[model samples]
Target: MTSFALHLLRHGAPVLPGRLMGHTDGEPTAEGIAACAAQAADLGAAHLVSSDLLRARAAAEAIGTPILDPRWRELDFGAWDGLAPDRVDPDALAGFWADPDANPPPGGERWSELVARVSAALGALAPAPTLAVTHGGAIRAALHLLCGFEQHQLWALDLPYGVLVSLRVWPGARPTAQIMGLYP
Candidate 1:
């Protein structure tokens, strides 16, 4: 059984900060680029993967020529893609939070869908040490899908800009992952 190491790196700060930012491409801030590049330099993964979005792609590009994969994109928030938290319908947002899978945002991707997409990507990259430069939501989905953590339990895990979360994966038809560490 060969174990592989997977590092999930959150993209740096976006130009439009404090917004949902899903599927809405935005430039990375200067500090975000610098921080992600610096952190990426420290990671020595054989392969680099990233979301196709601008912020993640820019950071991944700073590290190396990453394999841009749209599967790594942030959760599609649809109508609420670029809106601030306060702007969305409060009841709808509450329903989304209460049960995201069963109650998606007006036109957003279901939580289960995000988990499934990220899980498939993780399963495909099972053999080598890979660095996935992605978003906080994707990382959260991985945690939920791979580690069996409940959605509510994920709130305790702080995923900040340029955060790195390493996992040891035993890849198979039903893959399993053990958390290695978190680098903020």
Candidate 2:
């Protein structure tokens, strides 16, 4: 099977950090954008894509002209979109952490829904050296689809701002990938 390289880079810190930033459309700090650009500088990506949201788009623009795609956006948090986790009901928060599909944030999407959208995005990629500037949740959703990780394992990824993970993708009707490297 022919394989191509795929890089998934998490967007940098948003101006409004430490909140449920999912689908919030906040901008990244200058330093945050710089950090992301510096990390991707040597990646030699032939194609670049980003979430249309400002936080990820800013970092993608710092690197190169990117194809802005809303499919790469973060999981929609809905009622909890911009609130601190503590502000949400503790039980509800715990339930979401434990089983996102079973207990998504009110008015938001299920984990399976995120996986489906991300799978579509992954399937649409052209076989090339590609980089996608996206959010932690989007990256995690991709991991779940590509790596077959359980929800419990996905939470442990610890993908911080500006982190990038490389994968070797054998794309086809059933695309699969081996995680090549993870750069913090």
Candidate 3:
């Protein structure tokens, strides 16, 4: 069986946190940019992929490799996009977390939908060592696929800015992950 290695990276520090970032474009902080460069230096990927978001794209570019921009973005928080975590309704947040797979954000995409899109994108990528720069939600989704984690558990995973998580993928099986945190 032919195996491929995939490096998943979370984009560096973002500007806003209130609303759902989903497809909203945001740039990385100066420190975040440095972190991205450092992570790229650490991974040294041959092929790079990233979310179209400016933050993610910048990170991909810093890697100094060919990058593919994919449309599989983070879950749309809809009307909840820009609200702070504390400002959001506790019961609603709990409900969303309780059944993430089935529940869609007030105007956002469902967890299952995001998973499917990411899975398809992963399938379309060339089978080789590659780096994917994306958002925390995206990384969490990929982790769900790679680790068979429950939706609630997705938040449990620690994915810091510009971190590189290595995974080996095979046909019809869960990916094997080697998580490595890098310096900014």
Candidate 4:
């Protein structure tokens, strides 16, 4: 079986810095775009894709023309969208943190749902070196889908803005991948 590199790059910092930005469509700061572009500049990926949101798309455009895919969008926080952590109920937030599937944000997507969505997106990728400029949440979802990490385990990773995760994937009906590298 042949393996290809799949790079998941988190979008740069959004104009709205500290908030639950899922589906909020915040714009990226100029420096943030520059940082993301610089990080991806030398990656010679054969294909590039990005989330349809402004933050991700703008950062991706700084690097190159990217295929826009909504499936790469951040996890939907629904009612909690754009609110700061301090603004939300601590108990509710804790519930979400403890088990996202059972205690998703008021109207948000479940962890399993995010995994499923990312799984579909991953399944559709061609077996070639690819890079996707997307959200931290979406990147985590992809990690879960491809690497089989549980939601809690995924939380341990510190994927800040402009982070990159490279994976070696063997594409198939049930694809599998291994971590090749992680770049901050």
Candidate 5:
């Protein structure tokens, strides 16, 4: 079995306020950029990857490594993209929570769609230690695949700003992850 390490890093805080930020290009805050630099210093991997979004890409760039920007961006919240979750229709939100895989956001990509794209991205990476800086939703999707957490359980995973979660991928098997919150 090919043993490869996959480090999943969530992006830092964005400059936008009360915005969903899905598919939206938003830069990270000054603190966010500093946090990324600090986190990058502790990372030992040579390979790096990032979402196309500016927030994630900035973080990846701060790592001082070549990045593979993939089209598998965060889940498209569509009309809800810039709105707070609480501001969205309650029924719509509930429907999404109850059956996320089936019920996509209004004009947004479904969980299943995101999963497929992310899985493909995972397959495209070199079978070596790699770092992927992305959004919380992407991290949650990876956790679902790695740890068998149901969609509803995704909420339980607290992905802090600039946090790093390490996972080992064995070919033809599920990945295993160890989440280290904001490692220095």
Candidate 6:
């Protein structure tokens, strides 16, 4: 079966560090751009893609000219976008976390929705080595979809800013992934 290598690089730290930044555009700090660029330098993927969001785009652009795709954007936090965790309604936040599918943030995209969108985007790409600069949420969704990981298990990934996870995707009746490396 034909396969593709995907280097999923999480965007660098945003100007606002400790907020629910989903769908909220934030600029990458200079240091953040430098870190992500350095991490991306040796990846050597033939193609580069990025979320249309500012932070991810900045990092992606630093490494190479990237095809900006909205489908690669972070999970939409809706009313909670850009708000600090402590500021959101506790019960609502907990409920959303407990069952992301059953309870999306008030107007936010559901977990399943995010997974589907990202899957569709990935599936549409040509099978080849590619780098996608994206958000942590999008990366988590890709991991969940390709690795059969239970949603809650994803939280333990602990992927920080500028991390790169290399994956091989076997496209078929069910697309699958094998982790190649996790680069710091």
lDDT of 5 by residue, 1-184 (tens): 6777788887888887456788988878878867876776766776888897888888777776556565447788888886788889999888987887677789998998888778777767777888888888887887777667788888776677777777777645455545444352
Give each model's clash number.
Answer: 0, 0, 7, 0, 0, 0
TM-score for candidate 5: 0.88
lDDT of 4 at 54: 97
Which portions of model 4 show Cα errors greater than 4 Å? none
Candidate 4, residue 113: CA error in Å? 1.3
Model 5 ranges with Cα > 4 A deviation: 173-184
Q: Write the per-residue lDDT of candidate 3 for residues 1-184, one digit (tens) a residue.
A: 5767777777878776444566777667877777877766755466778887787887777776545556546777876776776777888888887886666668788888888888887767777778888877887887788767777887876677777677776645444444443333
Q: Write down the lDDT of every candidate, Cα atoms only.
A: 0.89, 0.91, 0.72, 0.91, 0.77, 0.91
Alpha-carbon runs more than 4 Å astray in model 3: 17-19, 172-184
Candidate 6 C-alpha lDDT tens digits along 8-97: 999999999989899999888988889889988877789999999999999999998999999999999999999999999999999988
Give the deviation of candidate 1 from the true structure as CA RMSD.
1.1
Candidate 4 lDDT score relative to the true structure: 0.91
- By summed lDDT, the worst window of 10 consecutive residues in model 4 runs over 111-120
The true-versus-predicted C-alpha distance at residue 126 of model 2, in Å, is 0.2
Q: What would the TM-scores of all predictions be?
A: 0.96, 0.98, 0.86, 0.97, 0.88, 0.97
Give residue 154's error in model 6 in angstroms. 0.5
Clashing pairs in 4: none
What does candidate 1's lDDT look like per residue over 1-184, in tens digits? 8988889999999988888898899999989988988877866799999999999999999899999999999999989999999999999888888888888876889988998899888876848888999999999998887788899788678899989899998877777789999889
Q: How far is candidate 6 from the true structure (C-alpha RMSD, Å)?
A: 1.0
The regions of model 6 sitting more than 4 angstroms off are: none
lDDT of 2 by residue, 1-184 (tens): 6899999999989888889998888979998999999889998889999999999999999999999998998999989999999899999999999999999999998888888889888988889999999999999988888878887899998999989999998888878889999999
* Candidate scoring better on lDDT of 2 and 5: 2
